[model samples]
Target: MKRSLPYLLLVVPYLLLPAVVQGQSKVRIACVGNSITFGHGLPNRTQNSYPGQLQKLLGDRYEVMNFGVSSKTVIRSVDNAYTTTSAYREALASKPDLVFIKLGTNDSRLPYRLKIDEFIPDYRQLIQSFKSLPTHPRIVLLLPVASFLTDTTRQTEQAISSLIIPRIRQVAFEEKCALIDLHALTIDHPDYFPDKLHPDSLGASVIARRLHEAVTSEEVKGFDFFAAIPQPASISSFYGYDCADFTLAGRACKVVKPRFAANGLPWIWRARFWGHEPQTDIALLDRGFHLVYCDVAELFGNAQAVAAWNTFYRFATKAGLAPKVALEGLSRGGVYSYNWAAENPEKVACIYADAPVLDLKSWPGGKGKGKGSPADWVIFKNDYGLISEEQALAFAGNPMDKVAEIVKGGYPMLHVVGDADDVVPVDENTAPFEQKVKALGGQIQVIHKPGIGHHPHSLPNPAPIVDFILKATKP
Candidate 1:
């Protein structure tokens, strides 16, 4: 979907926190705030909330919690019982290593008027509640997003800015917590908030990116080393099958010799990721190295057939190819790259997995044992040696199970997937694998294209990946 506002590119400022000071560590973070943190009116709810996005950027190392209530705030008011001290107490009990607090929006709009002195003290008490915790979690005060609608709401927001923000900053300084001036940033870029108050997906994405930059800038240092790979020369072939089988051409033999041969390459060849067959496109081939395209799922029913293709990296290595052979698998093809890379760490050099089916347990086969196509079920049963579907799933095709093994091996990988793809969900395909790769200290490069589909071959194209492979496969 095209964005209505240019809010995606906005950068959030740096935040000073203990997590940043401490560098990298497995810290538990909790988002305790009101409706804004609850992700009101957002299509994805908490899945794409600020905390959720932080989880993606932070990977699996940190445990992030979203303890936001729909109609809650810190101020005490009889009409708005939802926003009260009890909410604050519950948040304190969660005992997070890091806490992000976003309030004041609802508090600013509360029906009951309160003296500035009373409001300031109440806010101070809330900060103290978390500071009093035995664990003494690091805190970040998220300034409430600015309201950008009519003059009335803007006036109300400005009122809060005048009355609450100074105090919040003072409290943050006194309590020794990190203060993120989101209020000023959002005001500067009104386009970031689509509904004029709450953030749209793009707006949320911007906030998350800013938060990530802040944390990673201070906490993350130099990255692990990875060997460079080369790019494919040109488009040799794509995923579609030749139409000769179904056309009149099937019966008509060419009067002259066919211009291109499927076996034109000197090396043994099978699958194609882009362009047409018969011509040598460096984009598809790594010179001096055998390029094995294994599609076990049958290319989602295409003749270039591959299933769990991404996980089939070991097959190429086991076939006596050089240790520098690069792998490419899209959708179920990802199944091949991930699985093969996991098992044959020593042999395979790099991977180009696009929209891969990293987890078979959830795919081809749904959570239930009998959810996939008849062929898919049969393949799983036969390959893994199981009688029942559940047993087969329980026994085989779990990419996650082999993550540690791959991480220990430390192979270079490039993962490309679409953010909006409903077919091969990012969580099932690339997200978990990316997390595992990062955790095992392996090198993985991820490219996420927004508003794209599940076809990785098309979105990221084959050139860059081929390039990555060529450079990475050096002998």
Candidate 2:
């Protein structure tokens, strides 16, 4: 392979192996590619590389080998012909039963991309090398991981999209090799490739899981990841991704999927306000968190609401969502988040409240300095079995009342409030709660919008909110 890139890294040999498990004849799987495949810039590369993760996912049934070199291109005449590397030779000598060839990232760069004319032929030749093996290995072509370099250098995304991917698809068709479109799998998740060219450990796990499904013959006739859930009532587009609306225990539930599920399939369960100011939900979807919602509205996050959420939680976790989940509370949704967290503290990953109504007395109850919803107020009273205004006013069962218990759950909290919001004033709702959490030495962050109101629930740039959730749910 040509070594023209200035920062070409040494191939980590431990993640993938040159040998199989002792005393067992496991299927020999060889992962062949460049630095991305070699686990460049990833911590504990030997254990977190795509191949390493694949080895663990496949368990003792297969021996995965990582024969990856940095800056290696499939084009033999290029500055770094992947075929010229020791990894290439060793990969061939390993006599693999299965091969995943993920080349072309390096070839997408400026000077190297000049040799684009040779990609198809060279890639075809590379495929033949493994096809000629005695084991007659099944070859799988991996399109390069998508990059967000935003420039012409460092494996240009435009080059990969325009020059490389089509060629890989063509060669896969001609060679009859399996194709696992890594580019499509990862394009929406630029965050996975922190450096824009190489994926971190979490991103590597996405590739590994996709490969696992292929090897294990796991087939999903219409849907894949959400197949474990009950059949959806319908599937439609929600913010450019698949939205499965299904009935779970007689309640309508929605799950807007990411382009690909992130590692562990972490998710954010929205309590209410399905799509209002949905910037944060959309962003989390791109980062591989499923945006879910269960309609338990009108119940005002009462015991019934919490019970419904408990049922949804059990079903969702059973269907493969992480046991602990991030909770999204928009306005009245705060009640659902806090009430549920109070009931099932161990299940909450974190809480994000936007212009939330932490205290019923402030909003629907109208017992303080904030505009109250008369119609919802009646509904709220009846929902909580409040005999009259007296009962509703004195009800200390609201989210604000449960701050101590919620903080004791050990999940951090994030609040986005509009300082001028009269619909749900921060002073009566979130402010006192924040003060209490701080007084109790609990974790809580508040982002106040100076003049903004409650209409817009999230920030224009949801990065800070997303970052907070990501940090809390880091696996």
Candidate 3:
């Protein structure tokens, strides 16, 4: 038998060559792109490129290689006619189980012929080169990450990704390869990317996880055609109505009106503070920061909430309060406080939600009710033209979502909730939020009083919440 084995050895290479030559990634992946995929700005090679992160997500099950080149152009290779003529040969050399191509960022700036005309044929040739290999790996063309603003350059890039990348996908589909649309995963997630263009390690991790799930999961839907569109500004700006008074019409508000008019757009004011047991006299009188309160529709006094909030802003301005402000509210007032604070984070110095109802989606009675009161779901639908309960819920954005946004931008929050309060449960209110702030590498002060119930102002000492503000807001 030993003597016979020597004769078989000669033919073994020929048999094994087919398997080796055919790209069956027992478990390997190849990531190829520009600096965006290469983890530019990351201090170490072992740090957070999407490829490095993808390998970690796959554990030992898959091997991922990074073949990204900074300032490299796919057009340079394609117009010249080979996928890897000495130029990108280094990237082509790392044969992989799966290949991810993230191109077209730099390609958008080149001559139109290079991006639209030459790119497809060049990409087709590249695909052919890979298919010619004994081990033909699966290929995935990741759409280029979206840019910050839709300027001329970014518009060009977006157009390239929107138009040319589809051709790449068609080639992948014809070849039976995988396709991952990172453009969708990152559509509304701006905080993930540090600069508008490149993914921070955190952003890279998000892309990697999305990619991993796309490859491994049975139900990986490509980017949604109708996902939520961000408002194109910070949630904080919405809360503050930031410069709405000035920017929209390009002039300062000259006089206070019964109905707020911005650029002559008829608008009503709603204040969330006022009608508290002890009264927010101290807050109303503060000359340091202007406070914009959003009054509940009517419970805290219908249009009166808006009236009171405006009065305060007017009074504060009269009293020499700084343009930057802070918000404070209790129980129902919490809704107004959170909303206003979130909308105007830059102007909002801080926020104090004293036993406030943060989420209307899941609130008292696990339902909403009351006229002019924001708690009612049916009313929201009727009032806001919302078609469904989910739409209604989404209609009113969640300020809690912006807590990290606020903290990251240096606006602190102080929350005081009763642990035993059923009206606004601790677990549902500020407790979970406490964890979020900690996770985001931000700081928020939350004071939990054990055995306490519903009303935060009813606490024996409301002074602590006040004290936190004084300390936080002080120059």
> Model-by-model lDDT, in order?
0.54, 0.80, 0.52
Please provide, for model 1 over 1-475, each residue's C-alpha lDDT reduced to its tens digit, 9 standing for 90 to 100.
Answer: 1212211222221222344445645566778777778787788876788878888888876767777776555565444433364555566776567778877776555353353455556666777767778667766777666777664533266666676666665565455455554564465567767767787776677667656644553211111001111122122112111111111111111000111111111122223342322222222321222333332333332212223333332333232234344555566656555565565566556766767777766566665322445667566556555688568557544666667776766668888778876766777658877887787787899888888766534431244554576567543
What is the per-residue lDDT of model 3 for residues 126-196, given as tens digits with 9 covering 90 to 100?
66666676456555567666666555544344665566556655554445444455554565567766766
lDDT for position 417 in model 2:
93
Best by TM-score: 2
Q: Could you give the C-alpha RMSD of every candidate to the true structure, in order shown? A: 21.8, 12.1, 22.7
Show the lowest summed lDDT stretch of 10 residues, model 2: 1-10
Predicted candidate 2 versus true structure: per-residue lDDT over 1-475, tens digit per residue? 1112222223221112324433337778899989988999988998899999999998986889999898888888866898888898899998787798999888888787887898889888889878888767777777777888987776778888888877876686566565565665676788898887789999999899877855664111222446655874687666446778988888889987764456555899988978787767866765567889999988988888888888998877766667889999999999888999998999999999999988888888677887688888899889988988788788989887887888889999999999999899988988899999989888999998899888777875576898899889876
TM-score of each: 0.40, 0.57, 0.39
* Residue 50 alpha-carbon offset, candidate 3, angstroms: 0.4
Q: In candidate 3, which residue ranges exceed 4 Å CA deviation?
A: 1-26, 77-87, 112-115, 149-151, 154-157, 218-475
For model 3, what is the C-alpha lDDT against the true structure? Answer: 0.52
Off by over 4 Å in 1: 1-26, 77-90, 110-115, 151-155, 219-475
* Candidate achieving the largest lDDT: 2
Q: Residue 119 deviation, candidate 1, in Å?
A: 2.0
